[model samples]
Target: MKLLKIIIVLIGLITIISCKNEPKSLSDFKSNFYEIQHNGLRLGDSLNVYFFENEDLVKSVEIIWNGKLLKNHTIMDSTNTSLGINNLKIKVNLENNSISGETNVPILNSFKETLVEFEVVKEYPHPQELFTQGFFFHNNKIFESAGQYKKSKLVTYNLGSTNYLQEKKLDDRSFAEGAALLNGKIYQLTYRERDIFVYDEKTFELIETLKLPSILKEVWGITTNGKELIVADGTQNIYFFDEKFNLQRKIQIAGYASIYNQLNEMEFIQNKIYANVWQTNYVLIINPVSGAVEQYYDLASLSQTKGSDDVLNGIAAYGNNILVTGKNWNKIYELSVK
Candidate 1:
């Protein structure tokens, strides 16, 4: 009878051991186990994510925020996040079971951009027929890239010259967007074509066509700082590429309260990037490193001077003055914002 008792006790010990070693199952582990408590994940803000009552149950937490992996972080610092809907993925590794979920980040901030006023420096005659997609100053001429299905072209004219210096038209299928004169070569972007046309600066002869990265859905604006090319794709994101068209990095233009979108024509000057928010009369002066809008210039007065209600879409840096124009607009107004 004593041996039988010992055997029964041994069986009970085995049952307890098995139960203790077994992993706990959580049906809602991936669904409602965590919460993000911060100032709505704003730009330049850090995130604080925590599991409500399952902190002890969590063995480890891994996050993929904005397409970058972050270990031990529920969601990484938003200072490295994009402007609009940033992608987020979280995985919690428990003692035995592992679960993961993906969601979009809600990056809402409550701040306003500083409004900077402008005064008209001068006015220049711009071609009324040109659907200007890009505008910039190189040497003493204005290089413009116009966009349309069959009316796209690259044309150059002096700031005060009525006649164009050189004109090169694109084939019907290619809609030319932005152009920049870089290293004696003119790099022009084509909308929806995924192609960059390289040309000789003087002769405007087509040299070679480079393919754009697939990540950039549509190339809108193109510029250069004498070394790297800055590109925009309608969205708030701006991309930097080397002279060989290799992507170096990307930044999203963000204001204090909202993520600015429709970033069309771009020009880099005085170590700052000035971008035209498409269809709006706002020119955002952006900090290239932190992707913050330092100030914004309203072109509503200049926009109202247009013959038609075309969108203001062109910006060229001229020493201390900024030249602005729009599609099919008759006059280009040079402004002194300082």
Candidate 2:
């Protein structure tokens, strides 16, 4: 009995010692031991990682990127980046503890965009009161979503007719911004309401409404690649979401020199995203996979209206061409881009 009691005491002492010596998790650290200098970095830019003066506490340092240990790491140029959010971790080993710091390596476009020329092929009649926010073609018909408090609506009409075949007005508080038809449903975006109204494409009846994530400042443009939903928020960022409005991924749109902001009224065509730059006559053709603006077109001369609010803001696939119009404009110009 004495021997068993002695063994129990020894085990208790050993357990106490081990518990005291165990290292804490990285979250328990009170201060950051290292930093990557710039948390947001562009592709082809040099990166610098700085470690604080804590040689006494840190025995060794290991930098891991995307789950693999990096050896002799320096710059994170285009050769090593894939052009999205990248995970980076720095592990520091100490005498009695080890911890890791995590950060995101956002990659931006490194190449300049090429100017593309386009000419208007035809002009179609549009409602002068329609504040066009979203424009697209479906089954030889033109579908549009107009924005304004108490006036937001979704309508479908013929190509050359000013009469609406089907129309559905939103709630007085909802300001519809963008709309896209996917999988027999029409998904409409609200600017500040942060809600997506899903409707049956044929009946135009409300099926359900999905809430946008709080991380998004405001919903702007939206499109679908027949699979996932892609959205913009009037910023340099574009987000990809599943049918339920859950975000799958996000990318920062980058032009030649800087990040492009005010991205509104997007259209996905031929594996590329054509986005309208808000308040400007510029439309950027971006590679959806790389977030790179490969080309841009200027359509300043298409609009006859000179009002400051009549900025070019809509784009739609018109067979082999594209149809564009501005907010509250009376004409929809079809363009053929080379």
lDDT of each: 0.80, 0.82
lDDT of 1: 0.80
lDDT per residue for candidate 1 within 94-169, as digits (tens), equals 7656767776664643356688877887898989888999899888999999989899999999987658999999
Error of 1 at 265 (Å): 0.7
Best by TM-score: 1
Q: How do the predictions measure up, each by TM-score? A: 0.81, 0.76
| Model 1 clashing residue pairs (backbone) | none
lDDT of 2 by residue, 98-210 (tens): 77788766566677799888888999898878898888899989899999999999999998998999999998999999999889999999988878899999889999999
Best by lDDT: 2
lDDT (Cα, 0-100) at 338 in candidate 1 = 60
Candidate 1 at 309: error in angstroms? Answer: 8.5
